[model samples]
Target: MRIIFLGTSAGRPTKARNVTSIALKLPDPANGFWLIDCGEGTQHRLLSSKLKLNRLERILITHLHGDHIYGLPGLLTSRSYFDGAGPLQIYGPIGIRAYLEGVFEHSGVHLEYELDFIEIDSTGIIAQDDGFIVEAAPLEHRMPSYGYRITELPQPGHLDLTKLAELKVPPGPLYGRLKRGEDVKLAGGVIIRSSDVVGPSVPGRIVTILGDTKPCGNAVILAQGADLLVHEATFGAGMEEKAEAYGHSTVLQAAEIAAKAGVRQLLLTHFSSRFDDEAVEKLTADAQTIFPDTVAARDYLEIHVPRMGSNASSV
Candidate 1:
């Protein structure tokens, strides 16, 4: 999977950054995009990119802050302008229904497709299916907030065709059966074990995307053993007091959470407009003191979220 950051600024937009939005592009665009937080001008941000509106399948909002949610109405409506001829499933905190209902009513804009809502008022296993899961946890923002976690399902290891060929195992339905963990029995009564032909099962990848929050225990809990943590580092290390006062995290605090959570990679976003490019770099450098893989993100940045054990080849 890949993450495309549409916007990554905090509370406000700057010339270099827009507000908050992230896209988890699935193989099937019609299945829609898994969007996180539709900050103001989010649809416009997509206009500059290769993303299409009709592909937005699911939207997960972490909070009700304007910067995090203001783009929903416009995006949902603007979707009609594109080929969004189907329904959109939106997951967010409580009052999302009323909020969207009000916005559509106030603007006298009725949509052309379906609008389904899931109000996430608590933290738990918020979404799950055959392939993946999305969980939620409360965050210490001034208003009610949440952090989301995405876990992709494990995959079956690749079949070692060379092993089968070496064993004179003719490629046929028997190979398919063996790949599904069944021992293949040849008409000659030769039995081949699946273990000899397949490696271990592929492990799933864990990703935690945090909303605006302070250095709270919940952050660490949600981020445990994550492959990638998209967290908010709104301030520098020396500004911890300001960070706390504003209910946000400094670079050091974010790093400490990543370190404690044993995360493999840390990607920072939602930066305060106060810090410019150079300052954000300095802030990430400080975070690396606690976790070396820490990086501060910018708008339109592309990050490859590898499926677990793809390169390492370990389950």
Candidate 2:
């Protein structure tokens, strides 16, 4: 999986960054991509990106804040023009459906595809399927906000080619059957069990993306053991007071959460525009003091989340 940051600024767009939009692109085209938080000008950002808007299959809104959702109506409208004819699922806090309906109705806009909205007012598993599961938890923000924990379901292990070859198993359709954990009987009446020729299943990746929030217990719980933790750092290290007043987190606080959660990678976004390159560098350095594997994200930055071995924890 890959993560593309389209906007990384806090509150509003700046010359260097835009506000709060990130795309989680899965390897499979059928699964498409999932968007988190679409701020104003998000469609323009997508236009500039190498990614195709038509491949966006789901959108997860963090809150109703303008910096997080102002671009939803325009993005949905533009997607229709780009042949995005597939059903799109959207998950967000309560009032999201009403907000979108009001906007679309007032603007007299129509969509070409189906839209499914799942309004989350409490913490629990929001989505679960054969391939993955998504859970949400309330966050400490000025308004109702949430953090999402996306856990990829564990997959069956690879077929043991060496074992099959040693067994004189001819390479054919039977190989596929054995790979799928089915017993196959050869023409000679020899039965081969899949488990005997397949390795153990490998664990899946865990990713946690949080909305604008202060350092809280839920944030730590949601991020625990995550391969990648995407959190907002709307202020520098010494600006905790200002961060608290604004219902945001400082770089240090973000790093602290990642450290406490035992996360492997920490990607910090939603930066304040006031921080120049040098200031941003200082902020990142400060975060590294608490969590070494910390990255202060920039717009258009691409991150490929790593996959671990079977020993890694899975949901």
Candidate 3:
């Protein structure tokens, strides 16, 4: 899995960064990508990256804040020009559906694909498919905001090639069946059980993405044991008072949440445009004081989620 930061600024766009947007690319190219927080000018940002609008499958909006959703109508309309023709599901807070509908209706914009809008209220599982399960939790913000937890389902165990060879299994269709944990009959009339050769099942990965929020319990709950915790740090380390006043979090606060939740990696985004390079560096340093594996996100920055057994880092 890969994480691409399309826009990392908070509230508004800066010459250095845009607004809030994130792209989560699946392992399979055919699966396309999932978008989080389509802020203004998001489509223009996409054009600069390798991301294709037509390949966007699902869009998860955290809140109705303009910085988080103003680009939806434009993105939706422009998608058709990219040959986008499939079902696109968008999940968000209560007013999201009405907001999109209002925009589309007012502008007379038509989409080539089916648009599915799901409004989330309380905390619970929102989406579950064969590959992943998505959960949402209400967060502490001025408006109705939410945080999302995405977990990839457990994968099948690896087949022990040494054990299979020891069983005199030939390199043929039988290998596929054995790997699938199905008992296969050999030419010699011997039945081979997959359990005898397969390793333990690999645990899935968990990724948590939070919207604009102050320090809250829901942040820790949704981020528990996550491989990557994408939290908004709209203020610098020492700006806790200011952050709280604005219903936002400081870098230190976000780092504390990651540490408390036992998350492996902490990624800080949605930065205030007022932060210069020196201030941003101080925020990163302060966040690292609480959580060593923390990264300050910049626009267009790409981070690969470490495989189950690997170390997490930005590519």
Candidate 4:
């Protein structure tokens, strides 16, 4: 899986960054991508990105804030232009459905495809499929907000060719049955156990993407042991008081959460527009003091999250 940052600025857009849109591209292009947060100008940002509107499968909103959802209506409307645009699923806070319906109603805009909204009232498992399970938890923000934890399902282990060969098993339907964890009885009446031949199942990856929030217990719970943790860092180290007052987190606080969660990597985003390139670097440096795996996310930055137990880095 890969994460593409469409906009990384906080509150409003800057020359170098937009607000807070992110794309989580699946390994298969055909499966399309899932969007997290749709800040204003998000569709415009996608024009420059490799992601396609028709391939967008689901959208997960972190909050109802203007910076997080202002672009949603435009994006939904624009998606109709793409050929083969299938049904879309949107998950967000309770007011999200009303918000979208209100916009479409007032604007007199109709969509070509089906739009399904899953309004979240409580926190738990929000979505589950054959490939992934997504859970949501409340976050500490100015208003109602949430964080998502996406866990990929475990994959089947490889079949042990050597062990099969030693057992005199030929490559045929018997191999398939053995791989499926079924006991296979040979023509000679010898039974072979799948566990004795197949390797262990491979664990899937975990990714946690949080909304604009102050460092909170739920954030740690959502991010615990995640392969990648995406957190907001709207201020530098010295602005803790202001950050708390505004319902935001500083870079240091973000790093501390990542550390406590024991995540493999920390991605710091939703930066305040006040911080220029030099200031961002300084904040990142300070964060690294607490969590060495912390990375400051910028607009258009792409991070490839490798599978669990892989030697690959998430840069």
Candidate 5:
């Protein structure tokens, strides 16, 4: 899986940053992506990449703020233009269905694909499909907002071809059995044990994304041992007063959260427009003081979640 940032600026777009939108690409899945927070110009960002928007199955909205979802109607219309297929499931806090409906109604926009919206109020698992599960928690925003956690289930252990070849077993159901940790009995009392062929199952990966929120109770739990954490640092350490007043976290606060949660990698995004090019480095430096694996998020940044036994690194 990979995370591609479309817009990372907070409040408004600046010379170096846009707004808030991210695409989580699961190339192996039938529905390839979980598109989160379609800020303005998100379609333009999509057009710049080779990612197929038609493969998008889930759209997660953190809040109803314009900076978070102004690009929805445009993206949905653009999907129709591209002949997108399948229902688009969207999850938000509340009033999101009406909000989108009102926007489409006022704008006279129509679509050919189904659009599903789930507006929730409490913390719980929101969606589960294949081997992935997504959970939502309320965030401390000016408006009713939410943060999402995505967990990738571990895959079956790799098959041992050499062992099978030694056993003179041809390619067939025996390989499947070994991969699933099942011992297979061959003809003439020849038994092959799964322990002798299959390797250990890999650990699952977790990604936690917090939108426009302050450090709160659920944030740490949601981020515990996460592979990658995308949190908003709207203000730098210099503006802690403003950050607290607005229910937003500063750079240091974000780092503190990552350290406490024991996340492998920390990505600081949703930066205030006041600090653009210089802000990335300055805030990144401040965050590094707390956690060594901290990084400032930039527009169009591509982050890869490491494979089994691979080390995690910031993009």
Candidate 6:
């Protein structure tokens, strides 16, 4: 899996950054991509990236803040013209459905595809498929906000070829059945147990993406043991008081959460527009003091999240 940051600025846009949008691209291209947040100019940003509107499968909104959802209506409208005819699922807070319906009605816009809005009221497992499961939890934000934890399903282990060879098993449909953990009896009346020839199942990977929030317990719970933790660092170290007052987190607080969660890697984003590149670097350095694997996300940056036990790195 990979992550593409479309916008990284907080509250408003800057010369270098737009706002807060992220694209979580699954390993299978057929599954398309899931968008985390849709900040202003998000569709414009997508124009410059390799992602396509028609391939967008699902959208997961963090909050209703302008910086997080202003681009949603425009993007959805534009999708109609872009051959985005497949059914799309959207998950967000209670008002999300009303918000979109109101926009579409007032603007007299019609969509060519089906839109499924799944409004989230409580926290727990929000969505699940054969490949992955998504869980949501409340966060400490000025308004109602949430964080998402996505977990890939565990995969079957490889078949033990050497053991099969030792048993004089010929490669055929029986091998396929054995690989699927089925016991098969050979023509000679010898039964082979799949458990004796298959390795342990591979563990799935976890990724946590949080909305704008102050340091909170739910953040830690959502991010615990995640392969990648995306948290907002809207202020530098000395601005803790301002961050708290505004329902945001400073770089230090973000790093502390990453440390407590024991995540494999921390990605800091949603930077305040007041900080320039130099100031952002300084904040990242401060965060590294607490969590060495912290990365300051930038617009257009692509991060590759490998499988569990593999090192996650930026492209």
Score each candidate by Cα lDDT: 0.86, 0.90, 0.91, 0.93, 0.87, 0.94
Q: Compute each candidate's TM-score over C-alphas.
A: 0.91, 0.95, 0.96, 0.93, 0.94, 0.94
Clashing pairs in 1: 32-55, 32-57, 33-55, 33-56, 33-57
Q: Clashes per prediction?
A: 5, 0, 0, 0, 0, 0
Worst 10 residues of 6 by lDDT: 25-34
Show pairs that collide, candidate 5.
none
Per-candidate RMSD vs. true structure? 3.2, 3.0, 1.4, 2.1, 1.8, 1.8
lDDT of 3 at 195: 92
Q: Rank the candidates by lDDT, best first.
A: 6, 4, 3, 2, 5, 1
Q: What's model 4's lDDT at 228?
A: 95
Please write out the lDDT profile of model 6 over residues 1-315, one tens digit for every residue: 899999999999999999999999988745589999999899999999999989999999999999999999999999999764699999999999999999999999999999999999788999999889999999998999999999999877888999999998889998889878899998899999999888888888899999999999999999999999999999999898999899999999999999999999999999999999999999999999999999999999999999876777788
Candidate 3 or 4, higher TM-score? 3
Model 4 ranges off by over 4 Å: 165-178, 183-192, 312-315
**Model 5: per-residue Cα lDDT over 1-315, one tens digit each:** 889999999989987788899999884635478788999989888988768778888899999899999998888887876664678898997888998899999989888888998998999999987778999999887888888999988777777788789998768887887788888888867988888888878777899998789888788988999999999999888788898799899999999999999999999999888885875797899899999898777888888898657976545
Clashing pairs in model 6, backbone N/Cα/C closer than 3 A = none
Q: After superposition, how far is residue 172 of candidate 2 from its true place, in Å?
A: 3.9
Determine which window of 10 residues in candidate 3 has minimal summed lDDT.
25-34
Worst 10 residues of 5 by lDDT: 25-34
| lDDT score of residue 135 within candidate 3 | 97
Candidate 1 on 24-95: residue-level lDDT in tens?
Answer: 865432244689999999999999878788877789999898999999999999888876357888998898
Residue range 163-187, candidate 2, lDDT tens digits: 8899889999988888778999888
Judging by TM-score against the true structure, name the best candidate. 3
**Candidate closer to the true structure by TM-score (higher is better), 2 or 3:** 3
Record all residue pairs in model 2 with backbone atoms less than 3 Å apart, i.e. clashing: none
lDDT of predicted model 4: 0.93
